[model samples]
Target: MTTPTSCAYCQQRATQLCAGCRSVVYCSREHQKEHWKRGHKRECKCYEVTSNELLGRHLRATRDIRMGEQIMCEAPLVVGPKVAATPLCLGCHRNLLAPQKPAMTFYKCSSCSWPMCSKECEKSPFHLDECRLMAASNFQSKINYNPADPEGKESAYCVIMLLRCMQLKRSNPEAFARLAALEDHLKERIETPLYQVLRANLITFIKTVLGQRDWPELEILRIAAILDTNAFEVRQNGERRKVRAIFPGGAMIAHDCVPNLRHRFDDNMRIIFLAKRPIPKGAILSISYTQPLRSTVQRRVHLKQVKCFDCACERCSDPTELGTFAGAHLCGKCKVGKVISQNPLENAANWHCQLCNVKKSAREVLTQDARLQQEIESLDKTTPVHLEEFIQGHRIDLHDTNTHILQAKYALTQLYGTAPGYAMDELSEESLKRKVDLCEELLQISNLFDGGWSIFRGNLLIDLEEALVAQALRLQLASECESKLKRAEELLEEIKNIMKHEPEEMQQMLAERQQILNAAMAPFSVGVE
Candidate 1:
């Protein structure tokens, strides 16, 4: 395509091109700013949308992207509560307060008879569209406010985001068009039990009670499926407040077991994607829709179930999981050999012992894995004792790099510094050493998978650096103190770079960490007299 000579803003003859995309021309700096604010900013990105047979729609860098470069930041097209969610204010998406007294009722929206925090919430733009629709239809919400079970999931919240999406048909047709253009995989989901529930209950309620009969059942179901396929889980105010929002631009970035990009939400709830590693021009920009620590079988199964595709990514194809053996088990037959899948992508493929060639059926392997996972899950993790015992007990069966062991080790890293009687100051010398060792080991595995400026590596660095600082303070010898403090400084510098894109609170924590490290090093700054 020939570059246009006309300005994107005023359609006047133009000499300047956008530095970011170079696709649009601007007459002047003022026109550039105005054009960007008008919406060119969303279009001006390092990555462009691309598609394939496997990923359907995905993103690729249009130009070389530096490590930690901000790729895209987009506001949600629609935001609402999750389908099955704990009681939260629909207006603000915060957890609702428990009913205080004998009345056992929540503060309801006076207009819609739906539960909200206050009259202020009733007038919120998020609530008004649905409030007017519900009130006009005389639809009273059946969301029971049980004082005893205030934190329990409320099924009534399921209709909220769907209603918001449906409302966009009339309220904002352009947005609805963009939403409708997204891949919903409706055919893949329509027969599932969840869709069956929607068909029986949700469909009837929306069409009959809410009087959306003009909307076809299939079209409404498509919207639900779209939300499932594309929505990003937004966790705010730490992990306490959780909701879901969909960004059309964000939804285009496809999934990989090991992703090149990591995302975080800003205060305005805009989703920002950053390059976790340097990307050559035309490399696919990706994010992990599943946890990195999960075994290949577990991750593949989850991706298929949730994202409607099998991941044949490089990590998934490797039986040794890029030499970490995260998905392999210690062979019961050989007692020394690791059991690995014949083909990591095939669900029904046999697993064989490396030493003896002894085979285990996929069912047997999955069953054993599930039992071990359940055992680990059921163990009390408040203290490190149970986790340590579990790791020790399974050492012969699970081995060092087994997924279960890695998970337990990761948990122990968090528990050692924060759990009761295991605080950084309270930890014994042995436990401090153990925490450092765990962080180092996890950091290596993180490098193999989610490497280079990744959040996982950054978090491990934080843990390792803090432990190093503690070890430095604990040592009486100046040489040991200097060595550990120097290492801590190195780790802190990397942590700052990796987490520079993090939220303000995390940035503040990083500043505090630097101050603490500085205070620790102050004594060492002066020469021995």
Candidate 2:
């Protein structure tokens, strides 16, 4: 009707739409076949799923992609409450806050007898599929909707996602096929404690209570395994609502400590993957499955425990952790040398001081690291007093770039401006300078590990931008004020770009930031009354 846009292969007039996906238009049969042969055959969308023994199923770029390019935008196949989640609306997925009056109880769905926010939410599309299935089971939810402890997690919430997945077999077989095709790692997960619980509870509920005996025990467990491995944690509704969703295409992307891809969920809850840097064709696409601020050992352990895979990514293999030495500690013997692992990929490898050659057993290093972590965790973080003390006490033992130190610094960056009694205007001259210095140092580390439109970098930029603006407002000299203002302006522009794909709520916050920064920078004013 609209002339079919341009050909995907040649940028020429085209009418033939790709029959497989109907996403791309072809100029001619010859070009279509040629393009398919070139790589399009594998890519129904932007990246192609490929398999390897090391990484299992992984995605690769079908064509060269520019930085910040949106590579994939996929609607979730299924969405529901997390495996262990606080009480939330079954329909809207919003947190169910405790009622103001002690006697009042949460509204339950008329059909399913499950908690919902409102009558409108009871009719929500997300609730309908499960409402019908759950209603038919003649089983009423006994969630013990206690108004006193509304935020407490319900074990029953876990059954909803599994039921939704099981329903897809009849409701949407095509989507069910995609879900089935996903790597479940069931063999590896079957012996786990969680699976045993599922075997006793979830399997029995589906077969005996719900009267779904056709679904095999192994098949039911496989679905749970697939969800555990592939589901992405989704936070929405201004982050008050927490849920998990399965994006089949998104799960195909591999994991790396220093990943090339950054993903965000849109208002529609569709997962969008963007290239954080320019990616050459044939390169594998990756995103970090763990926190960027965690040390290599911490990340690797988390990956192995939850994901059931040993990560041998470039950043993990290098003991220096891309030269940040995030996991390294100060040598007790040398005092000057940084203690580093001999082989980062192996868990049992001995750590040695570079300068002193003092060897420490893996267990010894791990025990020391864990103790330090507990020390940091135990600190009273409401004020900067304990964090500052921790940093000063560990200066000789833990460098600024050490993972624990970085974690504290990042927290400080958030606390300085917003924390009660430590607001920007209330900050002393020394504390203001400290905030600026902390931000500048962290920005450098962020560039190395999570650079190029990453959420980590964007958040750091936001902090730095605000700090710079505050500094500019306080400075006496016009030139210094102007320089700080200029840098703040540049940072705000980048933040806008990085957060372009974020939800409406985030955009609203950015808008507020823009207004505040603009007011501060108005008329190039520097002198105070």
Candidate 3:
């Protein structure tokens, strides 16, 4: 865990990491001198790495923590590409740009022919160790970028992160030890289909092609399983560029669907975690490993598949899904009734309608739900007609707060402001009002599950604020515009509080948003939100 540095004299946040010992920090040179005289000279030392297995390798607070306080900031031990449906740069993990013309080929590394973004990425330190081994063994990448495939097919990217972890054993023994010590769940994984596939393909390829024969087969597989258990999906600007990273301190936090801790990555790729709410002393810090908007069944399946545990958190056990009813559907016999799982903790249990008390088998519910999801997925999201039609058609079977409806509504909010035919300025008064209704209703549902400071909530507030501003612009009366502008100001403040610890890209957007609101309000001599 990191020891946050403070200014020696003034006790303000430190902005400089010390050069001499690479340990302490100071806000200014004068404070550094004062601190050096007052016990810093003798006491300042490099932080010692420590481990605890008190709760089987989870983190604990050494001191009292307040809301929005940064507990720890850590650099990733290893960073590499994820198993992606889309082709991505092995180094940066951005979606690979498809060749404009048919004859052009995808980029590859000069040394090993592995997929990479450019010549600069071909020489990255992270790629060097794996590149050397692959080149030495005469291995070449078969991963190709296909322009026609929206999700570019590339199965070979899966092995890149695993290869990087294996190379650490020889290149850096200390990091290798830390990597080995993480939980692997080898007992559970060996029986899984993925591990079976790895045995047939990945294991044979490494030994026969890449020729790392000296490394034990089980150990190599164990490292891969360990990464699946603990590695964080690190990304900047939310969805823009994503890669897997292992942060020893940050990984120790446990999981909760409605987590009290929120995290963000810095420009240097350091994980910075802050309290999402007022956490008491000795409370175990946690972060959500799954999406907040997903229903209990969805979250449970994802957690069990990836993290290998069935969550029984407060929100997960509640049948109403923390009152959002994101998974609930209307009864077939009685349209007034809402159907929910009888026992949320057990996946195979029965579901019953609340008003009519009619029962349905778990298999029946699962199958029908999947069909609906598939039908929704097939809709073209670029325009609003199909989605609007879907909502109208399913109104009897699925309620307003059903998961598929919520998903469609979220998509429409984005489409309204930027879709080809529905730009904000081009929207009719009725269309703008429709957008406001969707945002406000979704936000109320969001509060039940996502709560105050979640990223889901932050994004919703942003959409709502813009809608409110648009409504203000359309209104002719002074009293009506005043009401809309005040509500917009309220939402703007909430957006800042929620996204304060987000990435630099998000921060830039926030700054620009504030400026736009300021410029709009200046004509009325109003203050900044």
Candidate 4:
């Protein structure tokens, strides 16, 4: 009366067995076949090992993993609050749907209608939580959630409360219950900080400058202002119209000098992480949590100043960490080699490359970077319509692989594909091809840095496939067109393998791709070649 084995596919306990592969058991033949077809055909055997637990875990490579293999799929554990902060679709967070007519705006939520494709999207699960909160407020509770602000900033108050909510959800239900109980009154203290110093200054400013009116938009600006003025360190890149103010949650993720993860956001405001490299089992996964090229001393100081934590990560401990004296060059005059401070925890001492007598303070470097960043920001606003000029200007200061340059390239990719006046459709064939070429170039860099089963890579593949298909359609050469069509098909298949769990969307994309391939190959069907 032994218990039956479990089905490998869904991990369900079953009495029935597979007829074809009697070695494996299943609840039904259909599941057995499905499992085999899904590439579980070879991993059906059971084995015994005599090694220690770590050896048993590490030594066994049950199957070979391809570079871009689909390892696992998981829905988000938690999504951000759906308050209207940005011009993104509430459902997917990709940019909002464009209006069909030139003059008319798209549909918005009846309640807040801040930014949405339609009322249908307003009911989406992603919008449910924030919408509920917003509804409870009678639409009066402005969470400082305007995502369309040119500064692309969020209210520190709102962000801090969100973080507090997340922490409470994990630690104390009673405390969470108390906060939830006060949900109605929560809007009143939207200007107050959880910390005392911030709270005192913020209240003073609210009384002095803003008066008593509950201007939600004004409140949001004030929060951003507090972050800009009082937050230990602020980094702003005006060219990008983006500011990265350190958040407690983002800070808690910790740091790794050679980080395995990179992150980006879509229009819907989702934080997506991609694997930069093959992370082996038992590896403590990490993200940089700061700019990668910053010297160890600079990174540590910035983290401690803003995050309120001392980082003793391996890279921070190394004297010549990140290989550039933390990007501080040697002082030729003194010839005494300067290094990142031995005590990174204490914000003592100006940067004096120990070897050279020359010294520069942390304030000096930060001030310079901030000033250059402002110049880049100013240039960014002017050049959105003139991309080539934008690229040329950014190239002068930021290296090709610098983060600023990569950010510029990403913008260029989007503009080339979708920017109305300066899009691929308006460009000549040569220019269109060049745009596609640049996208492909960046895609390669993205793969190198953010490749592991991530939404970023997946979306890039989709974009690349679309561009190739477009190129094939434009070309008159039957043979060249056929080759491009085949390449696109291969890329789509790779995408499917990586995104198989997303069957509904993947199936639709696959069918559309097949249709394009068939259309492209039709002219060559009756060819003599």
Q: Which candidate is the best by lDDT?
A: 1
| Per-model TM values vs. the true structure | 0.92, 0.89, 0.84, 0.49
lDDT of 3 by residue, 180-251 (tens): 888788888888999999999989988888887887889878988989998988776444567788887677
From the highest TM-score down, the ranking of the candidates is: 1, 2, 3, 4
Model 1 RMSD in Å is: 3.4
- When 1 and 2 are scored with TM-score, the better candidate is 1
lDDT for each residue of candidate 2 in 1-529, tens digit (9 for 90 to 100): 2335788889898989876445689989998998899888666665677898998888887667788888888899999999878778888788776344333467898987888888999999888988887788888887655656656778888999998899999989999999999988888889999999999988999899888999999999999999999999987767467799999988989999889999988777889899898888789999999989888998998998888889999989999999999999887887888999999999889999999969999999899889999999999889888899999999988988999999899889988988889999999888988998998999899888898889999998888888888889888998898888988889899999988888887789889989988887776754745
lDDT of 4 by residue, 345-441 (tens): 3445466656545666766645655665455466643324555665576544344544445555566666666665655456667656766776686
Name model 1 segments beyond 4 Å from true. Answer: 1-19, 22-43, 98-105, 238-240, 527-529
Model 4 residue 411 lDDT score: 62
Best by TM-score: 1
Off by over 4 Å in 3: 1-56, 61-64, 85-108, 117-120, 142-151, 237-240, 526-529
Displacement of the residue 345 alpha carbon in candidate 4, Å: 11
Q: What is the alpha-carbon lDDT of model 1 when measured against the actual structure?
A: 0.89
Q: Per-model C-alpha lDDT, please?
A: 0.89, 0.87, 0.79, 0.49
* lDDT for residue 305 in candidate 1, whole number 0-100: 89
